[model samples]
Target: MNIKQYLDSTYLKTAQQANLTEMENTKVVQHFIQEAIDEDFKLIMIRPDHVKLANDMILKHKSKVLIGTVIDFPNGNSDLEPKLQQAQTAINDHADELDFVINYEAFKNGEITLIKTEIIACAKLALSNKKNIKFIIEVAALSNHQIIQICALIKNTIIANFKEENFANIFVKSSTGFYTTINNLPNGATLETIILMLENSNPLPVKAAGGVRNIDDALTMIQLGVKRIGTSVAKTIADGHVSNENY
Candidate 1:
């Protein structure tokens, strides 16, 4: 397999941490877009504001690298209206895919209906726009049973409301790489969690995100039937280097 084709090289940092200003961040995003083009990776995920910057660069170079953006990132606590607005903005900026953070807190609180509504709304909006959607469940924050339950909820909801063919465009991603832990747990995708997600999310692809640091681990994820790998070190993995930068 061409490992680069399965990699979604990701960088979701905001301006203050990523650079001195938004303009500098655009330059950094442009560099990322060029790297994705050169490496021929499947996608490059960035914050919504830089989606246009990425799209502009990709078009300028006549590259096939897809542009993806994160919505309700790290926290799924945003209300539905704002989330929809943000997603619309990303769409207008030419994002090809959108990864949304699901409201696990609501699910854990027995608010299943609320979680379902939020996901359906976001998924429908993106799917209607011909953009792919991946819901980040933040696997590190839940138990194994919770993981299975959340995935099943999403799977069942999608099949009920959306056409079966649209399943290929939706995913249950492993993590957002930005959740607080009870005892300082590892905050990225784990093998056992990925397996659980893969088994539970039928028909829909599973994206292993967060802590993938090397080619060997990435290959392991692919071997487990994972359709996509999201990481800060995708280039390093494709080039056979071990990545130390933790997303």
Candidate 2:
């Protein structure tokens, strides 16, 4: 089933997070970009700081792999200006997709206006720049009801503010693959949560990220209608082997 095209091979860890020096971390990013090009994966999801690096490598090889970067990262608590600025920089650096971590805490706090404003503004920035946008809801930290509501909120906001033709460029991604849960629970995409996201965010596509470790998991997400799978083991899955690597 040509799974490589459905994968957004991801690496978003920082130097401190990975216990590596800055130069060492950048080498890892470079290797990931090269691997994505060699494997012809659909895209490479990385931190905003590495967007330029990915861009340069892809250009050098004349590869078709797209570049994707996160906007407010694992925590979506930043104000609107910073998020926009980060997204803008990534776009300027040739990122083809911008995955913004939605302000779910605000939603939990009943701050609907704040969340809605960011969604609209970020979506506008991405679409205006002709880049695809994905809103990561960080499912591990949210209840099922919150998952459904946030997905619907993002879908509804995009639909109301943009033309239907642009819907294909927007997505409700599952996670950042960096959330910590109680008792080490699944911090990324799970079948139950993905089902809720798919059903609630219809017509606006879904990218299943986190906890998708092997070929079986990837196939299940695709069968359930996910348009993309974000993982650190894209090559492993593409080669038809189950990876023990934790995303």
Candidate 3:
């Protein structure tokens, strides 16, 4: 596909949620969201705290927008209950979709059942209000074999959630930027891996995140079959094409 066509497609702008604690940080996020809205980017992924800010910005600018937020975030050690509560709170705050991390330890320990149960519980919590939930499997931490296993767990959990609640809008994500090993997301290989996983399992959508920094990287992933691209670099890419911006 052409670079511009891919650039014009759906990708996500991620504002580190923990940074929302400060006024300046929030303002920067708001500014980026506005720019993305003006450019008509596909989606904007912000921290839970920025939901109201993002929603207000979209309304003020008269732009139609889709909102996404993460649950359990960079680390997967948090108990499932709190993660479930966080997902519930995100939905209440008007997030259109949710992304969350799976319990890595459970999968690493070969406790497949526990992993399935945990994801199902969290997915259930998000769907309790009939919200769309996507699971972040932290692909950066998983070995090739573990990646497939994790995907299997996610597939089963998604099926289970659907059978019980029938609200299965699950997505498999690549990485949470919080972890050092994947502080940067591998573009080509990661996209290929995700495609392989999808081909082997049910056709759930996949989100490619972590180190996406430019238009080329974003386009490459999209061409490779990634339905979503997550990054903090949207402003950088947009700025490269526009003039007279306050830096």
Candidate 4:
């Protein structure tokens, strides 16, 4: 398979954390954007703040690589309003895909209704704008049953509220790649988690994020039916280089 086509070349760093001036940070984003266009990756997954930069560069080069941004990234605890507003801003900046972090904390607290309402609203907003969206359930934070339950809920809710056909436009993404695991547990997508996700959210597609650091692992996820792989090391995997970054 052409692994580049399945890769969502990603770079989601904060300005302070990266220790670069805002302008310099954007230059780094542009570098990844440029690389994606050159390597023909499936899309560029970045922070919401850099949507315009990536969009402008894609337009400038007339590249087919799509622009994707995160919503309530790393943590999915924001209220419905902020999530909607953020989604709107990303759409305005021409993001072709939006990856949302579902509030797993709320779900753990037995607030399934709140979680459902929030996801539906965001999904509708993105769908109405003709943009694809994915829900990052943060598998490392949940049990296998929770993963299955949440995946089914997202798939069912979207089908019931929106056009059932549009279910294909959405994905049940595995991890944010920012959540740390306890006792050194896997922090991102794993074979066991992917199996449960595929069993529960089969038609909805899955994006395996984190823990896929090489070509063999990426191809294994693909062979198991993951539609997308979100990583910061897509080029390394394609070039068959060694990268220590887990994500």
Q: Highest lDDT among the candidates is held by which one?
A: 2
Q: 1-247 in candidate 4: lDDT tens per residue?
A: 7989999999998877689998888888999999999999999999998999898889999999999999998899989999999999999999999999999999889998998899889988999999999999999999998998998888787777877688789999999988878788889999999999988986788999988888999999999999999999999999987689978
- What count of clashes does model 3 give? 1
Best by TM-score: 2
Model 4 residue pairs with clashes: none
Q: Candidates sorted by lDDT, descending order?
A: 2, 4, 1, 3
How much does candidate 4 score in TM-score?
A: 0.96
Give the residue spans of candidate 1 off by over 4 A.
Answer: none
What are the Cα lDDT values of the candidates?
0.90, 0.93, 0.66, 0.91
**Hey, what RMSD does candidate 3 come out at?**
5.1
Summarize candidate 2's per-residue lDDT along 1-247 as a digit string, tens digits.
7899999999999999999999999999999999999999999999988899999999999999999999998899999999999899898899999999998899999999999899999999999999999999999999999998999899899888899999999999999988888887889899999999999999999999988888999999999999999999999999888887667
* Clash counts for the predictions, in order: 0, 0, 1, 0
Give the lDDT of residue 58 in candidate 4. 93
Per-residue alpha-carbon lDDT of candidate 3 for residues 39-132, written as tens digits (9 for 90 to 100): 7766677778787878888888887657778787767778877887888888888887788878886789888777777877876776666666
The superposed Cα distance between candidate 1 and the true structure at residue 212, in angstroms, equals: 0.9
Comparing 1 with 3 on TM-score, the higher-scoring candidate is 1
Predict model 4's lDDT versus the native.
0.91
The true-versus-predicted C-alpha distance at residue 172 of model 1, in Å, is 0.6
Model 3 off-target regions past 4 Å? 1-21, 160-168, 182-189, 235-247
Off by over 4 Å in 2: none
